[model samples]
Every structure is written in structure tokens, then in C-alpha cells.
Target: MKKRTPKPLVAKKLIQPIPEKVEPIQTEKIENVYPLNQMIEKIKTDIGHSPDVIIRELKIGSKRVFDAAAVFIDGLANKDVIQKVLQNLLVDVRETELCEQAEITDLIKNFSLATGELQVLSDTPIDFNQLYDAVMSGDTILLFDGSPVAFKIGSKGWESRGIEEPSSEQNVRGPKDGFTENIRTNTALIRRRIIDKNLVFEPIKIGKRSKTEMTITYIKDLANEKIVNEVRERLSKIEIDAILESGYVESMIQDETYSPFPTVYNTERPDAVVGGLYEGRIAILVDGTPFVLVVPALFIHFMQSSEDYYQRADISTLIRLLRVGTFLLSLLTPAAYIAVTTFHQEMLPTTLLISLTAQREGVPFPAFIEALFMEVTFEILREAGIRMPRAVGAAISIVGALVLGQAAVEAGLVSATMVIVVSLTAISSFVTPKFNLAISVRMVRFIFMGLAASFGLFGIIIGLLVLIAHLCSLRSFGVPYLLPFAPFVLKDQKDGIIRLSLWSMTTRPKLIGGQDNVREKTAKPSP
Candidate 1:
């Protein structure tokens, strides 16, 4: 009976309940903060008794209005700075206008606080947030206990290496001051060289977690806007957990992630980064890393050093050619050996071929096997040598080289020729200025060696084609990785592979795909 009654009456309409419009809770603003003392007390309370943010009360004469305190990070701020600024504020500040009270800053600097020098307003002008930021950043903060605002005077005294010649990129003649981890010092070092108002240092904060301070140094009219935009865009696109060093930024902003070639080049020389800026490219400097990043970097740039331009053109040209040759050798030597021994034996002269065969006669493995074994062993030893203490690294490298080669040859594990080939390959990889570039080449060298072993000359061709295709596809800040070449720009060719006479390179590279194409107006050739 109950079921029959329900069936006759129940008509259910599907209805969803709408969420009630809750009035947004408004945050209450501080209607009126206490006078300096009360506000300071409130700040102290909020600080929850942190050791670094200290408050000390000191009396000045009979007025007793002069209450001052210092705020700074424990390690970042110097005691001498705190003592100097505080001492100056208390006793040195002269009342220039004869107003009993004067602004705090005038006294500390060349002038004492004048009558009109310091004025208090209902609205605090000096950014407390910014001042606190500077304080946290190794700066000293002077808070006049009575004043609503605090003055943050920079007292960042950090210990770093004296300007020394870059060990990585040694030069014969030039400023020996390589960049240090201190950004201000590095910027100052660069500014010392470029006595121009156009040299602007634009700072940007990056890294969501690291919050690393990065600077974009560029000449006003010299740097192309398109490239600048590209650089900024790529950097903005970087979403990472941290950027501890310049390498982290380099990895994030490179043109091609998978390509063996490097799209962004790094240097320790301030002149080099400045030179890149002059060329209308963007340069990035990270706070903790001395290495600076240069974008729109071309393949030819790595073959060059700051010393190259400093030296005679002829000598520089020769050295640059040697570098290029070394790069080729490093990437191809092991592969060439495998190719010749496996299938291209006719390419070698009869005597050399006979000598190689003689060494290989007792070897149990094929040429590919021998080369791979030697190459891997050398890579392991090289890595260990690098990781070991510097004092013993050289010794380890020497011993490792000798033992790996001699033992392998004697054991019939690898041919003596293979040992020589792999060893030469390892040495040649260092010709590139950047260690990252050299590392990438080292990795690809093995791939080419593998290809060569499988199909000899054919394998080498395929491997090179793959590399070229990948490079051509890569773009660094919108510039092609194989730029000014591969695509074959005849005008920009003057600067690639070989550096031409100064006048000959009057025109800037186009495939750099920059907004500005001219390095100079009329072709004034370098004699």
C-alpha cells in the first residue's frame, strides 16, 4: 500500500544546488601605525626575535629623540660598516641649516644633516620593502627610531678572488681581471673597460626557488631589439627549480636541447661578453657564477679567444685554423681509424697501412672493438683525472694514459694504432674554448666511432649528416645554430672558419639574423 501511494505522487526533478555567493572577506589595513617606537616594537614582535634583525636603544644628548638601530644579514653585513654608519649618524651629522634635527644620510656622507635636509612626511617615501631587500642582501639598514622610514646604505663587503687572469682562457696581453661571483664587482669590472653611458646594466631576477639575480648587459644602440626580445623571451620561458650557475641558464636557453653543438657560449672575460654586446647580441651574467653567457653564439665563435684579436691577425688566423682542425680531428679521428681499418684501407698509404696491420696482427678484437675499448677507457680516466685533486690530477692523467695504452696493447686487447687514435681524439677535443662544447663533442665522437665500425666510410657520412641536420634545425634565441654557414651566407662568411682582415669583416653577420647588419658604415678594411 505504501509503495502504491509513493508511485502515484513522486515526481522527482533533477536540480543542482548553486553555491551561495559568499561576500569576499576584506583584509583590514593598518588605519594608523604607532609613532616610530611603537612601529619598531611591532616589527620586533613580528620578527619573532630573530638574531639578525636587532634593535638597540641609545640616547643622544638631553633631547633623547635620537634612537637608532641596524638591520643586516649576519654573514653578509660587515661590522665595520655598521659601526661607521651608526657612528656617523649619531655624532657626525652636522645641522647645516642650524635646524637642531637633520636628515640622517647627510651626516654620514660628505655633508652633515642640514636644516631642510631631512623632512618627515605622513606618507613614508623611501620604500621600506626595497630597503629591507637591500638589508637582506648584505647591506646595512639605518632606522632612525623616530623616523617612519629607514635608509639602506650599501655595505656589501664580500671576499672573492682578486682579478686574476682566467685560467680557462689565458691571454698574453689585456686586463687580467676575470669576472668574479660578485655581480656588482663583475659589473664594475666591465664598466671600468667600457667608459660609455650607453653601456647599460639591466638587472632581472630569475629562478622561482633560487631567486638568482641576473643582469642583462647591452649597449643601448648597439644591441638589436629583436635579439634582445628573443633573449628575454627565452629566459622568461625558462621554468626550472633552480639556476645555481650560468650553466643552468645556458642549458635552459640553448637553441637545441638534443644537438651536440652549443648554441649559447660562456666566457670569463668581461671584454669578450662586452664584445658580444657590441656585436648586437645579448649577454647574461649570473650572481654566483663568474662565467657570463653570450647568446646568438655561432659555431665559429668558439674557435676564437679574446687573445686572438689581441695578437697579430696572421698569427691569430693560424691559431684559429689549428683550433678548427683540432675540433675536426677530435670528432673524427677515432671514426676515421675504424673506417680505414674496417673498410677504407685503400685510403691510407701502403707503409702506414702495413704498420697498422702489423700492430693489429696479434689483436684479438676487430678495429671497432679495439677503438671503442680504448676510447671508453680514456674517457673514464679523463673523468677521474678531472675529479681527482688538482695536484694529483696531472699525475693521474699521465699514468692513466700510459697504463691504459701500454697494458691494452701488450695484452692484445687493442692495437697500438687504436690507442694512439683514441688518445689523440681525447687531446683534440679540448681545442674548443668552452668545456661544455668539448664534452658534447666527446659524446658524439663515440657515436661516430660506432657508425664507422658498422659501415666504414658510409657510417661516417651518415653520422655527419645527422649531426648537420640536427644543428641546422636548432636555434639559439631565434638564431640558427649552423648560422652564417650551412645555409651559406656569402657576406657573413668573412667571419666564419677564418677571420678575414679587419676591413674585410666590415659587415656584421646576417644569419645571426640580427636587426643590425652593419658593423661599420664604409668598408674600412683591417690592413
Candidate 2:
């Protein structure tokens, strides 16, 4: 039999050609420069002539010689700033002699504009992209009829929710101010806390269509330059159309994408970001998001609270220990219950075993199903409470949980002991300070529950081993997820698991802080 040659494989055409390199926005200078009238028309057309966009034509430099226009968005640009610019150009310029040959751009930039923050778009031909970005970002733009240059005055203003106590990260003894949606306000809050000149806020604009503003802030002297550069590189690689929230940037720049655990830490408290910055961590603040992302976040960081540093060392240590214990309880309680009741009934004492057995007597399902049903029900009620309207949300959650749990117990669908276990677990889960970490625990709980159901107590141990291994392998911007624990940094022990006295923590975390790790050099205080 003659073996026929295999048919030649057909090469398939790709739907889209992949570019070898993705370029960052605003890199290339726009060469197309149009005259004043044509530029105004282009702006109107490009911006779809939105009613909110206001363009007021006026003459500048006395004698109405130099024709100019003030362009800005009505709501975004501060009305006062626009008025000040108009006054300077329209009213203030009248006193000066009309000069046709004088440098009007220089005159307006130097002597006319009252704003503190202003930028000259260009000396020669104005970059339209920069001009468009300026107007869109709430800056009032000044255009001249004959000159190619333009002025971008910092006039960003929009109605934003005032800085209020963060609902999610409330503390009894710490500052009440939290980060607002405005990026500038958030940076100011941080700056207020740390007035050092070394503290830096490097700005960059991301997203193609959204052109969302972002800042990567870190102390130049303390932050590890390698980590900062890694963060910068990752962010630069992002080529998205829009970044609606900090979460978008977090998802793009995080080290572990598929892991259930969050590699990036986010919080609404400005104090928290300040603390992270002091610890040599870089914070990524995105415009329009109250939650700021802190990088190279460790497992211990999530377990800690800003209040920890505010309170006495002993009290904070005790509270932190309680939190760690409760976290374990929340993760292991249901799984332990399932394993003991299903496979190792011998592990329970005679009296408690008999009581649990009696409770399960009326229940039709196995221990695993009973626990799973109650946990899921509680989670549903919790989600409902959060999503529902504020006035009715809490009432609905409480009423729903009580009614559902009581009804289920009465109907013999779940054991009373199972309900108690689930309630304890849910309450314990809330003890976790970081919402993202709590969510990770919640998701891991189910896996442990499944493992317990299949292979009993042995399965739980195996699951925990795998979980720890996974966490050990994770990194947040090159820093280990379980820093100071897996790496065993003795110096960082002062602030890990339990925080020592403030003076005792003389150095920052070895892996995170650069060579300049000495935080303080004072001796311990004593009376």
C-alpha cells in the first residue's frame, strides 16, 4: 500500500494584525495646526458641539487688535477662573496700549492670567491633542487668531462628593477624612500628612478614549526604585479605551491576574495610603475613584488596620491577634464541622456529639449540604443588604436572615447547630479589615468545605497546604505576598502579625523599602 503524503496544512488568516509594540498616548507631536476660526470649528466638530462646551470669542491687548477665544466646558471649568481669565483678557488688557506686533501669548501667560497653574501649549504651532486634552480636563484654553501658540489655564472644577468619613474603613481613633473621587483632592490629603519634599506624585494619563488621569506616588528616597519602575512599566503597557475606576488599573497592573487573592491593596482612607507611603509602598491614584491602590501589598498588610498604629501597642497587638484568630475560624469553622460530622464523628465529645446528632436527626440533608445552604443564604442576604437602598437595606438583611434561618430550622431543612456554625463563620469573616481579603477568604471557604466533604479532616489540611503554597508563590510588583513570613525577615517582625511600640520599628520592611530603611533612630521612651 502506497502511503499518500499528508495534505498541506492551510495557513489561516488572522482577523487582526497584532502590533509588535504598543505605544503610549501623547508621544507623537501633532503637526496639523489650523488658524483660530478653523481651530474653533474643529474643536466644536471634534467635541460634537456639546451644549456644555462654551466658547466665548473676544479681542485682547486693547484697541481690540488681537482677536482671541476662551474655550472651556461649562460645568467642569470653574466659573470664577473663567471669569478671571475673561476679565484679564477683556477688561484688564484695555488699560495697556494696543500693540499689533507685541508677543500676545507671552503677555497673557506672564501678566494677564491670574491662575497659579498654567501651561503654554507650544511656542510655535500648538499641539491640538494637548489643547483638546486641556479643554476636556476642565482647563480654560486661550486661542489667538494669528499666533500658533495657545494657553492652557488650570481651571479644573466639577461637583464632587465632599470628603466624608469613609463608610467602609471607619476607625474610632484615627483621622476622619477619606479620599474623594477627585485625584487632586486625594493627593492633597496625602500631601497634608507627609510634607517632606522627597514625597513625589508622578502624573501620567492612561486610556485612549477616556484619557483618564493617574498618579503613581512614592517617596523618592524610601521607595524601592525597582518596584517603582516595574509599576511604571506595567501601567505603560496598558492600552485600554477607558479606565472607569481604580479597579481597572489594578486589574491591568497586578502581578497575579487569575489568583483569587488580590495582589493590589485598595482603601478609601487617605491615612491608609499615607501609612503605606511611609512604609515605602507606591500608591496608584486614579481620577474619579475614591479607593486608591497601594502596591507590593503583603498578607500582613491586609490583616492590619490604620487604627493599629493609633492605639497602644499592647491593645493593638491583642486586637490583631483576635483578627488573625477570627480569620482562621471563619475559614475553618464550616469545613471542620463538615469533616467531623461526616467522617470523624469520633473527634467530637460524647455529649456534644449526641447533641449535634439530635439536631441533625430532623434534618434530611447531610452536614455538608446543610452548612453550604446556610452559608450561601447568609451571603445572599448580605449582598442584598449592601445593594438595596440605604433606609431599607439593613432592615431587610436582618429580617431576612432571622426569618430565613428560623424558618429553615423549623422546617427541618437545616440543623440548628449548622445555622449556628454558619452565623459564627459569617460574623468572623466580617472581622477581616480588608474587604478584598475577606472576599478571598469567603471564596476559599467553599473550596475547603468541598475538600472536607470528600476526604474529611485530611482534606482540609491538604487544602490549607495548597492555599499557603499558592499565596507564597504570589507577588505584588515583585514583592512576596507573604513577605516577612515566608522570607523570614527578623527586622520586620516588629510590625508583622503584631506591631511593636512605634519606636521599636526602627526600619521599614526589608523587601519593600530601599536601602534607606531606617525609619527612626530614637531610643525607647521611658519615664
Candidate 3:
């Protein structure tokens, strides 16, 4: 027993294995050979032997020391530029004999390739990775035999939609030309409006797979430095696979992820972008989407229209008031109907209450349910209209809504007053100048209706307070979302909620307009 106890008294120590030091793996660098034939074979292998890639092989120089090839994608590159380069190397060079002592590279580069904008990659040949990008971007690449170099020739011509008026943001007065899907064409439209030397269009490529091109357009002197840097920083941080449209970027960089409100504004009209730029906000234009995103969007900005500034101040002010009034109505009408009918019937006038009560007498559902039924049906009809063929969408939407509402009322599924209320709400939602804001209001209305059904007007009040609190907490690239309202900047109010005369709005938006807030002198015209 003593020997067993002594053996059991020994303590066991834990043994830890030493961690291995891992070395970083090196990637193999693919280099092009001196012969043009090898480079062509390598390209064919690299691009997976795609049939769309056109590789036109031809001979160059008097002795044909360099057997050259022009490579480009069939649909992307301009056939004219490719043919011209070939004519210069093959046909044009044969007409004039190359100097016996002259270097072929210099003779071809200086004399033959001088017609178009050409870039010679003499520094260890063109990287195949870069060559793929060039060809995909509609540029032609010329590789030569016995030369470790290639020429990237500009041949970026493809069919694109011509400049047309924006259908969404139509105005009574302004430039008819809107932004096109082509980025360069979009930038040119902005440049035509803002002729100032300080205007800058900085290009960047986002989306790993799509490689979508985006341009950040802003006035250097007028835009705040911090805002511009923040814009660039957020864009650089985007690591998505593809950006199919401007809305994708908007959803990515927006501050409030859960809120229904849009922190970033988008418009197809070039004037709207130019207007945003002049206010010291940065405009982001994405290729292949007509909508351009404008940052630092204020709540008041969504209530405004491109037509607001085009007319007399009095007229714009009236229209803006109507929009604001309708916006509130759209958001509250259905909820108010629910609250009064379910919880506050005494609030309505005696005659109106009698009429509503009589209409709802045979209805099977409660007030909230009736309102919800009509609203959902209207939404379905609207979506169907939008998804249907454009030629018949409008007609279908109008007929569908009319027939459904009338049938619902006749069947005693909902009260006639409830039908009228939902229809009015739907129409009022369209009064909002910006569709994004209108959509936000549409979503928020549902929440309000739920609240009203649960706790009457008190619930609606709580929802509003919560909404305002959330908006106050939100920002667009560090600028407050509820500008000139929550913080209450008096100077910015001249353009907020109402339109003043053009001369009266001499100062740009106080927060984003940088130190140069004064857009121009506030000199009033003397009659």
C-alpha cells in the first residue's frame, strides 16, 4: 500500500508542441516571349480560346523581322481602328521602304502607329492581365515578333443609347439631355453644364468581377475636403462582386441600414447632379445606369423637385407646399382612418360617423383589416402594372384598381369610405417629388397603420417620435440627414421647405458647401 501511494504521488506536466512558422507563398508571374506567335498562343490559352476574340496576324517592316498581330474583342473594339492599324503596318509600310539602318520599333512606332492615340508598352512587354483588361475595355493590342513590347491602341467604339430626356425626372424647364448609361457620355453632359476649371471628375473602378467604372464629380473649391475624402474612402472600401446599377452602390454606402428612408439621392437628370455639385455635394455616376447618386442628401432635398427652381419662386413655393402637404397625407390618411374608426369614433363629425358606420355595418373585417385589404390589393395591382408590358401597364393598373375597389365595396369586404381613403393615400404617395422618398413614405405608412390598429393615435405618435429619433441619429457621409430641421440651421432654411428667389439663396448649404459657401453675390435686380 505504501509503494502504490508513492507511485501515485507524482504530478503530470502538460506538454505543448512548438508552433510552426508559416512562409508566405509566392505566385508565379507569367511573362510574354519575344516572338509574336508565342504571345498569341498564350493569349488564346489565357482567354479560354474564346471565339469572340479576334486575332488578326500580319507582317511588318521591310525584312518582316516583326510578324505583328492585332488582338481585340469582336463586339467591343471598333473595327475601323483595327483595320486602320493593320493597313498602316501591312499596306502603308510596303509603299515606303523602311530605311536599311533604321530600327524597326522606332520606324513603326513613330511613323506607322502615329495616326491614333497609341501607348507602347516597351517596359518588359504588356502584362497579359493588363492585355485582357485592355481588350475587354474595347482597346486593341498590337504584339510584335522579336520585341518584348505591345501597343495598346484606342478603339473604344460600341453601340450605346443616345442622349435622351430623362423619363423619371421630367421638368417643365431645364436641359432636355439626361445622363446616358455610358460613363464618358455622362461626364461630358456634366462638363457641358459646369464649365468651371475647378470642376473635377475623378474616375474609379469598383466591383471585382464587373469592374464597373464610377466617376465622382464635384467642384474642387466649393466641395468640402472632408466630404470628398469620405466619399472616396467609402467607395474604396466597397468589395462587392458586381455593381449592376447605381442603386447597388447607394445601398452599400448608405449610413442607415434598417431605416426605410434613403440617405443617398439618385436622379437621371444631369441638371440635378450639377445642382448637387454646386451645393458642395459629391455626385457618383456609375456606368450602365442612368441614375447618378448624390451624397449628403437632406430630408428637405427629397421634398424638392428639379422643376422647383426653374419657375418663379412663388410658383415653386406653392408646388412644394402641396407636395409637403400630400406627403403627410399619404403617410397618415389610412392610419388616421384606422385609429378613428377603431378607437376614436367620437372624434369624427356626427353625420360622417353615421355614414361610415352604416357603410361598415355589414363588413366582416375590422377597420384596420379593411384598410389593409384595400392597400395590399392596390400594391399588387401597382406591381402588376409595372411588371406588365409598358404599352398596357398603365391601362391595366387603372382598370384593375377601379374594378377591384368597386367590387370590394359592393361585396361588403370593406367600407366605401375605407376604399376612398386607401385610393387617396395611393395617389398622394405619388405627389412626392423623389420616388425614393415616396417609397420610404409608402413603407412607413404600413408601420403607422399597424401602430394605429394596436394603440390608436398614441401608437402613431410613438412611431413618429421613433422615426424622427432614428433620422436624427443618421447621416450621409457625416452630414446630418435631417438638415436645417433637427439642428435647425437658419441660413439653410431659405432653400428648405420653400423656394426663395434665386438671388436670395446666395449661400450654399451651410454644412457641405465648404468655406466658399457664398455661391454668388446676392444682388437684387432693380426694376
Q: lDDT winner among the candidates?
A: 2
lDDT of 3: 0.83
Give the C-alpha lDDT of model 2: 0.86
User: What lDDT does the true structure give each of the candidates?
Assistant: 0.71, 0.86, 0.83
TM-score of 3: 0.92
lDDT of 1 by residue, 407-482 (tens): 8778888887777777788888877777877888888988999899889999999988988878778777777677
Candidate 2 has a TM-score of 0.92
After superposition, which runs of candidate 1 have C-alpha atoms over 4 Å from their true positions?
1-32, 35-56, 93-132, 144-147, 239-242, 346-351, 511-527
Model 3 residue runs over 4 Å out of place are 1-29, 63-65, 94-102
How does candidate 1 fare on TM-score? 0.83
Candidate 2 lDDT tens digits, 1-527: 98665311111220122346534323333234434566677777777889999999986643335668989998999999888879887777643442233466666776778889887776544566778788889999988765667788899989999989999987899999999999999999999999999999899999999999999999999999999999999999999999999999988888888899998999999989999999899999999989999988889999999999999999999999999999999999999999999999998899999999998898989888888899999999999999999999999999998999999999999988888899999999999999999999999999999999999999999999999999999998888899899989888888888789998788888989876889778788989
Ranking of all candidate structures by their lDDT, best first? 2, 3, 1
Worst 10 residues of 2 by lDDT: 7-16
Clashing residue pairs found in predicted model 1: 97-115, 503-525, 503-526
Evaluate model 1: give its lDDT. 0.71
Q: What is the lDDT of residue 489 in candidate 2?
A: 85
